[model samples]
Target: MQMIKQKVGARVRELRNQKGLSQEKLALAADIDRTYIASVESGKRNISIVNLEKLIIALDTSFAEFFEGM
Candidate 1:
């Protein structure tokens, strides 16, 4: 589970960077807290499905695309 969280976090970071979005930017777009984004990226938070969906939408990406190579 810990590894899964880290993997997801890494993937989120990759996508965010690919989209040239900062943590605060992404958080605002996703309507989540910036600290939450930081925690998620640092693998300290296991994000909920609803929040993940919000983040994906904010990234303008689909779940399949987001989870690719994971």
Candidate 2:
């Protein structure tokens, strides 16, 4: 159950890479820290709902859309 966040994080990372966006770029677009994004991608951070929304928006996706294949 808790692994869902990690999965979501991984999916986000995959999509970001697929779109040719660096962690720093995504963080800048999302108004978040690059380290934070790195942590999430590495499954080292348990993101808050707020931060999750920031990532979703940065990826230009909805939560449901972002999580569809996750």
Candidate 3:
């Protein structure tokens, strides 16, 4: 679970960076708090399915696509 969370975080950060998005911007896009995004990126937060959906939508990806190659 921990590894999965961390990998998800790492993937988010990577994708966000690739898209030239800041944590705050990504949070806004996901309709989540900036701090929450930071916490997740820092590996200090457990991601819920709702939050994951937000992120997937924010990234314009399907869950499978979002998690692909991660």
TM-score of each: 0.94, 0.88, 0.88
Off by over 4 Å in 1: none
lDDT of 1 by residue, 1-70 (tens): 4798898889899999999999989999999999999999999898899999999999999999988877
What's model 3's lDDT at 10? 84
Which regions of candidate 3 fall more than 4 Å away from where they truly are?
none
Instruction: Report the lDDT tens digits of candidate 3 across residue range 1-70.
Output: 4788788888888878988898888899999999999888877788899998998788777888777876
RMSD of 3: 1.3
Measured by lDDT, the strongest candidate is 1
Residue 39, candidate 1: alpha-carbon lDDT: 91
Please report the TM-score between candidate 2 and the true structure: 0.88
lDDT scores for all predictions?
0.92, 0.87, 0.85
Instruction: Rate residue 63 of model 2 by lDDT.
Output: 82
The window of 10 residues in a row where model 2 has the poorest summed lDDT is 1-10
lDDT of 2 by residue, 1-70 (tens): 6797688678989889888999999999999999989989988788888999998888888888886866
Q: How many clashes in each structure?
A: 0, 0, 0
Model 1, position 12: C-alpha lDDT score: 90
Best by TM-score: 1
